[model samples]
Target: MATINTAVLDTFITLTGIKPLAVDVSPVLRERKAALLSILPHWEGAEQSGIFAENFFPDRSVGHRKKELDDLIAQTGNVTGSTEIKAENQLRGSFMLNCPNGNIRVFFTLSPENPPLIQQLDFSLAK
Candidate 1:
């Protein structure tokens, strides 16, 4: 089986044609929680909140991320260019997007269940 990080990178490259510069793999649960805390407030009661929360938990479900990725595919039609893997694991991994010619932002999703977080998840810049 492919390591989760490799899987994510592979997926991104296959779909978008871009290679991410950095891939942060959460070594422990605490770090993931901390990362979640930083993002939770913005999505507290939004339509996608539940999915977002689910990605942060130990399970690392990707239901939300998949939706986002699908949407991106629909919107962009293509996925290559400049990118960064903000976070990654068996659960969710975020991206710092430097698209063909657009702005930069962070996109994260919990597991394969959800689509990859896309422009909507773009919160400021990837730290």
Candidate 2:
């Protein structure tokens, strides 16, 4: 099991302004998502090794997570469109985004104290 680089993770947070809770880097390797690969120089070896590209989500290295994400991108074209909408009455705090090929539903477990805003940024080109 490879370990995630604290320094690299810190840099990522600083540049993206988002805490690294979880991440998917599979798309970085694909031609469609290769542009994102430049942002992460630390993952070069891992990406070539085919660590996460072949494996699924589990307790593993950041490189593996990226590989898995690339695989996911291969399966799901791209996050085409998204919308910030309210959740159902039953859910305490929930939000969802509709991608081109799929939808991401986020359920907030924490209270409404300084909720994180979901911003849409184009990270890759669609296929």
Candidate 3:
């Protein structure tokens, strides 16, 4: 029997059904975009918020990094590129942004589940 089966390929096709794989940045991008679109102006309630909450423990100083994320979203329009696989369970995705301020890279890390969570999000301009 083949080591890899059709289910694997089928999943890829289904998850990325909307767009061709060659052009589809990533399936997680779809989930992120969908959630953001629905909860934008109020992303705190988005499904992905749980992922953020787990990663960025809220501090009392101010709100969590939600505001910072908001700012980044405003700057970086959308994902106009492909997602890079850092590991079997991690992926790196960049958006369509050109900031003299700083270059941002969103690292997505997997939980026990198949759908990963947003891990480290930084926009440090300092080299």
How many clashes would you count in candidate 1?
18
Ranking according to lDDT, highest score first:
3, 1, 2
Q: RMSD in angstroms, all models?
A: 15.4, 18.9, 11.0
Q: What local lDDT score does residue 63 receive in model 1, on the 0 to 100 scale?
A: 48
Best by TM-score: 3
lDDT of 2 by residue, 1-127 (tens): 1246877777888998985343232221132123223333234554343323233223365566456555545555544544442333221233333455654443322222233211211123223
Stretches of candidate 3 off by over 4 Å are: 1-24, 46-53, 58-62, 69-90, 97-113, 123-127
Which stretches of model 2 miss by more than 4 angstroms?
A: 1-73, 88-92, 111-127
Model 2 CA lDDT for position 105: 45
- Give residue 33's lDDT in candidate 1 (0 to 100): 38
lDDT per residue as tens, model 3, 1-127: 3547777877888988766434445667456534433543344565445544353444211244557655764665542333343232224443322334443454433334556555444442222
Task: List lDDT for all candidates, in order.
Answer: 0.44, 0.37, 0.46
TM-score of 2: 0.26
What C-alpha lDDT does candidate 3 achieve relative to the native structure? 0.46
RMSD of candidate 1 to the true fold? 15.4
User: Comparing 2 and 3 by TM-score, which wins?
Assistant: 3
Error of 2 at 13 (Å): 48
Candidate 1 has a TM-score of 0.26
